[model samples]
Target: MTTATPYDAMFSGVIGQDYEMLKLLAPLAVEMSRLVGATVSQHPKTDDKPLSVVELGGGTGITTLSILAATDAIQLLSVDNEPVMQGQAQKKLQAWQAQGKLAFCLDDALSALQQLANGSVDVVASAYTLHNFTNGYRQQVISEIFRVLKPAGQFVNGDRYALDDIDQHTRTTQTEVGRYFRILTAANKLDLLEHWMVHLFSDESENHIMRESLALQQLAAAGFAGIHLSNRSEVNALVTAYKPR
Candidate 1:
């Protein structure tokens, strides 16, 4: 009894298949989801109302599912500009949406964060999303994250935090790309491989990749306290910080 949206026509098959391929190929994604989910779940309750969590990206609902699965005490708003991507998420997380535990904002991350009132959110979380933003805009988004967080509210990001050592970063990227080609080719998923290669190129873009040192510096500069790398797997890392009470 569901109405078919335009996204269904465009992304219903290919996008979902691509994400499934990603899950198989990128183990770091699994870790990112786990870390972000556990971090959100562990936040101390502020009141009787469910914890309010804002998720950036929400691509295909992987991280969204993690956040929801980790706890029933959260009311989550997941933001993404891509209709097809969010549509994929909507399909995956329809139950939560139906239960009134989840919502979606069809907008860019920075703009969505800006719309939130000062000191409004309990946690801001993302996975493999912020590193794709242009540096200046990413900084603005970081500042806004600080602006919207209630005192003692948390920001947890499990993302591609490139190694500060350029040599190691390059070597790691090469190895990962090789693995991607091997895996996808073996699976006869060359189309997905191409998609991932393009994404990898974006991740390696000088204007985009947020190195570990810079990420910590930006979080600290944004007035977040106790900023630190909580978990790491090669360039993938879990960065956690909190707003001061």
Candidate 2:
């Protein structure tokens, strides 16, 4: 049986090459530091204590490392379904963990969220993973997220762009689409590039492409307030919101 390749350089081909992803990622880190005052945990502490953080769908650990490098956060929990990706992440964060900095849990998103006690975390983060499921599953995942966050706790999602709605005909323009293509060209991985572009362009999976606005709205309806645009690049955006205290 053929399982999904966990180490997909194609993701960087799609999301990373977007000038917006690069630009917004830097500022988002600074903003996260300013907004969430949690420090990297030095000693073992219960979730009831202060400044706990859990990250869902962290693949290969690049973003996780970026967050740790940018902030003084503890109780770092990263979850993903792909073992190859998780292994890469574990290797990357091994040194920090040697000094007591990070940890990982391999599980599906909802189960991972459920494992955490309610109202325990200061911030919950997920990147680029929101756009992979159907609307119902997405809503269910968001509801679980709503349930886990501490009152006043923050959730920041470095996710997809708000594409054009069905009725109105507006989306990232051809030029922007070309930009995504250019990244693939530059990356020089033709086989992977062709596979992804074919799937993405052909609409092989409609439910997988989560509309950014609808996601924000759903999060809002789930009782998360203070929603705001945390990052934007061309068509992709990473939004943030909070569960009230």
Candidate 3:
């Protein structure tokens, strides 16, 4: 029998039903579609074919459904390692799958991306997922995203970023914790709040999110141009970057 890692164990039942967390993807979907549309418009070859998009860590299909509703895309491949999460997404995206507009792959995001041909994808997007990777592994994932993207292809990601200053990071984390605590308490969901608190304080290296500046720097090093923070609230941010044409 295999034992679950701390990360897997923590997220096993908690991630899929977190409606508050999932709702953030709605606005992120709009922003991501806009960036994709803007980028495809700039490149005529992309306009000639249907846009191919890959979404990493597609939990519960919230982001996928939001994107599908907000954008017109030829193909979308949603990749995730968790079977339960994938099942949720698959159920939600069945109509799109039947229409050849969406598909779900049961695989790790990095492994799935590595299997794709270089410069084949038009866009890659993710929400609240990549932050689970350590800075080093996250950089590797960014590099793979860079490799797989066609020239001028875009990557839009919505996730938490570490603050550059220690004090600010602490304050931001504290504020977020307080906000969640109050909300959960008001909703009489102390059990859920406890689960979140435990995960928040977990000492896993993979839980360490990179600062926005460092993340942008990594994207630049991976040969992405036009990197920018498109949206932000407290520690969460939506960032967009492009592979140079």
Candidate 4:
């Protein structure tokens, strides 16, 4: 598991299908960047220069790679709990890190956030990972994101959130999420996500489920403002909320 091929643990052989999901997700992804940029650009500390960005839960580094490739980040750090995942990302972003343009860390998202100086980051990002935690833990993890972000920093994602009533005990719920959940009641994409989860757990009973409405409340509870649903497709939803300075 500690070997270089981290996506093996992060995807369970399923993330290879992610690029396909982008067809339904791209426009929303663009809006996400706009929201983040609008906020970061207004930072009192912001000059004409692009700000630093850190992608939490940056599994296999695809999302991090996109951000690194597309933006002018002063620094980019890829954080994940799995060393394999982080290692995979480190390899992808190594050339940038080699030039001191980016860095990667093998740590839980919250711990990685803790390693940064408070209010020092322009953006704290995660993709498809928040719903992986129970309600309480997710809140704690996100609050840590708040602590690390500069006054006008942003939290952005093309993440997958879940619906309630799945009867998964290890999960917590806030609101119902995703455009597809309301359609494929029985054969939800969780079935696909499970392909990615099989190596980590013994049963589906321990999986985390999300409800969108409740999640927004949780984000609000954490003192985030501008909660918005950016876009949607069959299974994934583009969403964002921000920490007010």
Candidate-wise lDDT, in order: 0.87, 0.62, 0.73, 0.60
Better of 2 and 3 by TM-score: 3
* Residue runs of model 2 more than 4 Å from their true location after superposition: 1-50, 165-173, 183-188, 198-205
- Highest lDDT model number: 1
In model 2, the clashing pairs are 20-233, 39-72, 39-73, 40-72, 40-73, 40-74, 41-74, 152-244, 152-245
Instruction: List CA RMSD, all candidates.
Output: 5.0, 6.0, 3.8, 7.3
Sort by TM-score, best first: what order?
A: 1, 3, 2, 4
Compose the digit string of candidate 1's lDDT tens values, residues 1-245: 13563223223345445676777788888878988999999999979999999999988898999999998978999998777688889998999999999999998999999899999999999998898888999999999999999999999999999999999999988999989989989999876676677667777888988999988999999999988896778778899999999
Better of 1 and 2 by lDDT: 1
lDDT of 3 by residue, 1-245 (tens): 12453342345665445644524423443454344345433433456567788989877776777667656656889998888677877877899899998888888888999999999998888877787776777888999999999998888887766667768878978877787777778877776676677666652243455677888899999999988895576666778888998
Worst 10 residues of 3 by lDDT: 1-10
Scanning candidate 1 in windows of ten residues, the lowest lDDT window is 1-10
Off by over 4 Å in 3: 1-10, 17-45, 202-207
RMSD after Cα superposition, model 3: 3.8
166-198, model 2: which lDDT tens digit per residue?
A: 433134435444654666568674554555555
Model 4 worst lDDT window (10 residues): 169-178
TM of each candidate vs. truth: 0.92, 0.74, 0.83, 0.68
